[model samples]
Target: MSEEKYTLETVLSVKRWAANLFSFTMTRPSAFRFTAGQFARIGIQVEGELIVRAYSIVSSPFDETLEFFSIVVPEGAFTSQLQYLKPGDQIYLEKIPYGFLTLARYQEPAPHDLWLLATGTGLAPFISMLQDFETWQKYRHIVLAYSVRTQQELAYVDRINEIQNIFGENGAEFCFLPIITRDPFAKLNHRLPKLIESGDLEQEADLKFNVESSHVMLCGNPQMVEDTKEALKCRGLIMNRRGVGNIAVENYW
Candidate 1:
């Protein structure tokens, strides 16, 4: 990892979604630039040591401010302190952005459908991608499936709905699916791998997951990323490599 000098950014706003989930915005440095799906290393000083962690940017690249979504980990060195962030708090932001989970990664056999499957805070990067006009223009359809343990943990519901409305008028069709494993009343109540294996996910989206037309991006829990990758492979999808193939993944935890 690069130990480049970090930039100090002031927190512009913070909104709590649940007891453990929140999203915050910070001042964006003039020189900092990143694609929608990239992540930045953020630091917070605790005791005397600076603790840094990678978080996906939730704001669009065109946005003046940077935003990130996080879940508070009990006794966690980084998020435990991050949960208390106020509007004026100072946070350390690395200069460079990193990650390959962008739309540019898909090449050659161009994908007609885009699938963004995420769990918990993994939904952050997809939010950024959805806000980008290029993403709407690139594909014929886009499906975003965000899974959480319960309804309360589902963050950015309003913003996501707004994005859907804004992009729905454009060329591509946008579908947002919220999967709540612990909520029986929720529309979808199963894990992602199971949903993929059983074809329930495609059924809900009214789309099929095939190697040719679909480019699936998986993020969030490590186990979910691994298992979901395998499930897609079983359906004949391959990992995105050398700017080719159908699936892309990022392990958020």
Candidate 2:
């Protein structure tokens, strides 16, 4: 890691959570530049020491400013005070954004369908990807499946719904499927691998999974990612590495 420049920017908004709190878009310095789906190390200069953590870039890369999605770990040394940030308060950000979650690293030449599976705050990177025009240009159909434990855990609800409506009626082929495992009111009820194995996802969504034509991206709890990877392997999907093809994973617990 190179020496990064950090700055204090205003806190745009505060989002409350069961255990953690999320802060929305904040101001960015003129020199900050990064692609969507990347992450930056953030810190706060407080109490004669620096408390910092890494967070994913949740906003579209085309945006003029910066945006990040984060969780306030209860009793956490760094996040305890971060959760109380005011609108004009300053937050720290690393000068450089870095991560392998960007689409530029996908090995496939061309894929028919792009499947982005996420759980909890793991959906941040996918949020960045779904909003980018480049994603639409790469794949004909995009299926983003997100699963959360409870309804309150669901974030970015309105914006994702808006994106669904905007793309559904238009020529763009994109679908957003929100799955709540604990809420029976949700459209789907189960983890992604179980849904994939039982055929419920395909039947309900009217989409078929073809290894030859589909590319899968997984981000979430390590268990979900590992299990889903195994399930896909049983279906003839292999990991997409620098030289391989089809599946890519960013397991962040």
Candidate 3:
């Protein structure tokens, strides 16, 4: 890791979600430069040892500062320490933010929707982009699917709901759908592949997933990412590469 240090200039109120799950917002470092969907490696010094983990940026790039939404995984090496960090503490970070999920890689299909499929902390990047005005300027419509184990894990729902409620009347569209696997509150109780097959996904959002007209960005648990990609491929969508097509994905696990 590079020998760099960042000061936590401010620590917003710590908010709790479910049992043992909490999120904190920290002020961005002046040196951090990242796109809406990129991630940064962060760490803290513990007994002279460096403990770090990669985290997606939850705050929009257009904002003056950065923020991240994270879960406190008990006994998790890095998160354990991070949960205790206070305002003004020094946090280590690698200057570069890198990931494949950025909008620059996707080709806009004419008059189609941009689907951002995420689960758990994977929702981070989508939050960053949805808040970004550029995303609305690029895609005619945007659909964000956030999957979690339970309804309580559906953090940031209020803000996302507000975003949709505020801008939904315009030409651009926003839909926030929460998927709870272990609870009855899920809009689509099954995973993405099942939802795609049964038409539940399209019916719920009033959109279709045609390869020629849709751009899919996948992020989340490795299993969910792989399954969603295979399903999309079966439906004729190709993975996005610099020289190829536009089905981008990132593994949050």
Candidate 4:
């Protein structure tokens, strides 16, 4: 591993979605540059040592400020210190950005539909992609499927709505599907893979995904990514490798 260039930044805002989920914004340095879907190593001092974790970038590159979404594990060493952050508090960031989940990774023939699947804070990168101009220009239709234990765990609804409206403004087709596995409010109450395997996802999108013209991006839980990848494979979607295939995944593990 390369030595990290730790940059000091200040927290600007914090929004808590649930007991375990939260998001925060920070001061972006003028020299910092990254793609919308990339992640950065963020840290805070605990005791006398530095503890760090990689968080997907929630703010688009075009935005002047920096943002990150995180899940607070009750006993996590990093989150223990991170959860206490306040506005004006200091946070450290690695100068270099990293991640495979980005628009730049999916090259060549534009997909007819771009499916962004996320669970929990996994929605962070997709939010960044949606906020950027390139994503809107790359696909004719965008389907965002965000799954959580309950609808209450769905963070950044207002920001999501704003992006959907922006897509609407451009006369583009955008579908935001919220799947709550623990909620019985809707009949389609299965996990993302099951929903796709059973065709509920296609029903919701009103568009079918063909091998040649459909791109899928997965993030969030590792198991969800693997299982969903298998489900998507049944539909002929291949995982991206060395610049091939139609699926891009963020393996945060």
By lDDT, the best candidate is: 1
Q: Give the Cα error of residue 92 in candidate 2, in Å.
A: 1.5
TM-score, model 1 to reference? 0.97
Candidate 1 structure quality by residue, lDDT tens digits, 1-253: 3346798999999999999999999999989999999999999998978999999999999999999999999889999999999999999999999999999989946869999999999999999999998899889999999999998898899999898888667758998999999999888999999999999999999999988889999999999999999999999999999988998999976
Error of 3 at 101 (Å): 1.0
Report the lDDT of model 3 for residue 103: 84
Q: How far is candidate 4 from the true structure (C-alpha RMSD, Å)?
A: 1.9
Tens digit of per-residue lDDT, candidate 4, span 2-116: 2457889999999888888889999998888998889998888888788888999999999989999888888889986788778999988888898879877766436567899
TM-score of 4: 0.95
What overall lDDT goes with each candidate model? Answer: 0.93, 0.77, 0.77, 0.86
Instruction: Give the alpha carbon lDDT tens digit for every residue of 101-151 in model 3.
Output: 888776544436799999788898988888776677777878898888887
Worst 10 residues of 4 by lDDT: 103-112
RMSD versus native structure for model 2:
2.4
What total of clashing residue pairs does each candidate reach? Answer: 0, 1, 0, 0
Native-referenced Cα lDDT, model 3? 0.77
List the candidate numbers ranked by TM-score, top first. Answer: 1, 4, 3, 2
Residue ranges of candidate 4 with Cα displaced over 4 Å? 1-4
- Name the weakest run of 10 consecutive residues (lDDT summed) in model 1: 1-10
Q: State the lDDT of candidate 2 residue by residue for 2-30, as single tens digits.
A: 24477667777655655564747788777
